[model samples]
Target: MPLYDYQCSRCGEFRAFRPMRDSQLPQACPECDVLCERTLSAPFLSGASDGCLSRPQGAAPGGSWRKMCGFGCSGAGCH
Candidate 1:
């Protein structure tokens, strides 16, 4: 099962776990019981720093691998 985000007009947004087959189906809001549509959301990367996804790779001003990748990379096998 994968977690997805849904938005209800009355109750705002919420997350739910469902199979991929049901991803396109509308989900009932837990708070208001109203059918809500699935919303587009970005994947959350654990331990990732802010701006990691916003910037292109190797585009950091300082050119540090850690800052460029936002992963505090150790330079081992890193391009």
Candidate 2:
């Protein structure tokens, strides 16, 4: 299974992952109950033989953390 990041359309931020065949919907927001979006992401902690490095969310391509956590925009897009 791959680790993924998901943002709540209603709430804020959250992370999630499951079987590649599984659903990508959030049950509820840690802050509030709302839907979320799934974002395919890059490796957060590279357990490579070299060393481990933590990349910030929305970083570059390979070093980037996906933000499928719903629309980060405000206004009517709120779930």
Candidate 3:
């Protein structure tokens, strides 16, 4: 199972744990029980410095690092 971020029109944003088989299925908001749609999320790094993600891998200025996942996968999806 994987945790997915969802946003409901009536409610707001929430996360749910669902199996891959149920990914396409509509999710109900925990607060309002309304159908919620999945939303794109960025990867999170615990204990990372504030500017690490925005900075280049090297110490050079105006440098850019390779993007881990252009598709924007997070958590277990990253591996």
lDDT of 2 at 51: 14
lDDT of each residue in 1-79, candidate 1, tens digit only = 5667677676565666779999999998766688999988875444633322222433433233234443443343333
Candidate 2 positional error at 7, Å: 1.4
Put down candidate 3 lDDT per residue, 7-76, tens digits, no spaces: 6675455566679899878898765677877777764333322222222233333222224322233322
- Candidate 2, residue 44: the lDDT equals 51
Give each model's whole-structure lDDT: 0.58, 0.42, 0.51
What's the candidate order when arranged by decreasing TM-score? 1, 3, 2
| lDDT by residue for model 2 (8-66), tens | 55444455545666645543443455666665565556332221112234433332222
Predicted structure 1: lDDT: 0.58
Candidate achieving higher lDDT, 1 or 2: 1
Backbone clashes, candidate 1:
0
**Per-model TM values vs. the true structure:** 0.55, 0.40, 0.51
Clashing pairs in 3: none
Candidate maximizing TM-score: 1
Candidate order (lDDT): 1, 3, 2
Candidate 3: residue 79 Cα off by (Å): 29
